[model samples]
Target: MDKTLHYLFDPLCGWCYGAAPAVSGLLESGGVSLELLPTGLFSGEGARPLDDAFAAYAWSNDQRIERLTGQRFSEKYRDRILGDRRQLFDSGPATVALTAVSLTEPARELEALEAIQHARYVDGNDVISLATLADLLRALGLDDAAAKLSHPDAELLGANQARMSRAQALMREFGARGVPTLIVGSGAKRQLLDHAAAYSNPRALISQLEAA
Candidate 1:
């Protein structure tokens, strides 16, 4: 049987960043098709101001994630991104940016995501801003994707919305409460893998997928 892994995540999610290595492992395994589905969890109505209390909470959670996954959540990120109160913690721009890449250069979507995540968590760049997101896309040599951000096509917007809806529906079906949820297999026979293993033991994750 053919297998596919649907990775549901939000760009601004620290746990999703933590899960990055395992996801990359799955992609590199060549065992199954990998589909990235953005959950839009921190976009639109889900966005909120970067206030003091939330920044502290986010940094603490990020530290724990770093310990678990060994993904860097730098002090620069802590002071600049989590400290900035002027901009909202919105994943809309980043999501749209990835969607643009998915639409224009399908093969490079994951690369775009990894770059965007690195820009936010490591370099302390504002992935939440359109201009910054455009620059990141350009840096990755995705000039077409960078251009699309300034004038998004209707198809791009629709695809993003549809993907988000499908991801959210799957989340509800699985009774999952947050991002970094993984569903292995295709169609009705699909199963939800243990999300925690994506951070703790990626080899086990590959084993599960190979079995699936």
Candidate 2:
């Protein structure tokens, strides 16, 4: 059997951020092949605006996710992003930038994810703009995102869309309800891990996947 795990997540998702440590741990264990599937839960063409009430709701929920997973959602984010007068929280450009990096420099996808996450959840940078994304890419030693944006060979945008399609297929196949989902197995046999407990315990998912 190929000891591989498919990690499906959205870059802007709070739950997915919370799941980072476990996922990172699993990745570091070297026992499984990691295939990241970005879901674009808050990215791409159809992202909704972040209204005041909606922002508050998201922050409260994010607090819970932080508590459970020990992931930090800094006060800087609240004060600088949520409380500030500026109102911009679109994730499309960030996702597209990530897609670009993933294609042109696949080895640094995890670093890109972390940089974006820190920018939003810690530094409170407006990650929706191409300029910000480009700055992050440059900071992380990736190519100049502006150049990549125009590069005809970059297949990340399309690949990101394809990943979303695969995520939908996985959701339907596993009867999942939302993002930050995991399907442990392949073909006709698979185990779904959508709840916090199962997600926190990789061994539980491994057992279920083996049984499946």
Candidate 3:
């Protein structure tokens, strides 16, 4: 039977940054297919401005992530992104950008996610703008792919929505409360891996899935 791994996450999530290394490791192993699901966990309809309180909270959380996962939350983002305090903290554009990239070049979906994340979290670029996203995609040699990201008729849009629905269904199926979740099994006997292990070491979680 073909095995698949469903990775539910929101682009603006801080913990997702911490989980990047493990996710990259899982992909590099070539043992499972990762389905990237985008959840708008932060910022709603319109882009919400980033405030001092929000920045402080994010910095605290990011510091914790850095301490635990060894992921660098650069000083540039700390001083620049948060310092500017002018840009909105919206993930919709970035999420849609990934969806666009996925439609044109499915194989590079993860790379796009990583790029966008690095753009926002490290390089301090605003992922909420079409121009910046296009620039990033072009830099990745995915300019044409990025174009499809904004198309109204792209099938990947439906795929992205379906992925979100599947994630929510899994949540209801497993009594999950948030994104960055994991579900193991094929059909009726599936299990939810909601423990801290799922957060820190996705490889261990995948090992558990293999055992299951």
How many residue pairs clash in each candidate at the backbone level? 0, 0, 1
Candidate 3 minimal-lDDT segment of 10 residues: 187-196
User: lDDT, candidate 2, residue 3?
Assistant: 54
Reference-based TM-score of each model: 0.96, 0.84, 0.86
Model 1, position 95, has a per-residue lDDT of 94
lDDT per residue as tens, model 2, 122-145:
888887767777878887778755
Rank candidates by lDDT, best first: 1, 3, 2
Instruction: Identify the candidate with maximal TM-score.
Output: 1
Better of 1 and 2 by TM-score: 1
**lDDT (tens digit, per residue) of candidate 1 on 1-212:** 36889999999999999999999998788857878899999998999999999999999999999999999998889888998999799999899999899888988888899999999899998888889999889999999999999788898789889989999999999898998999997666889888888888999988888777
lDDT tens string, model 3, 90-172?
87777778878777787898888888888878887777787788889989999776666646454756776766666667777
Q: Give each prediction's root-mean-square deviation over alpha carbons.
A: 1.3, 2.9, 2.5
In candidate 3, list every pair of residues with a backbone clash.
Answer: 100-149
Model 2 residue runs over 4 Å out of place are: 44-46, 84-88, 144-146, 150-154, 186-189, 198-212
List candidate 3 stretches off by more than 4 Å: 43-47, 150-160, 187-189, 198-203
Best by lDDT: 1
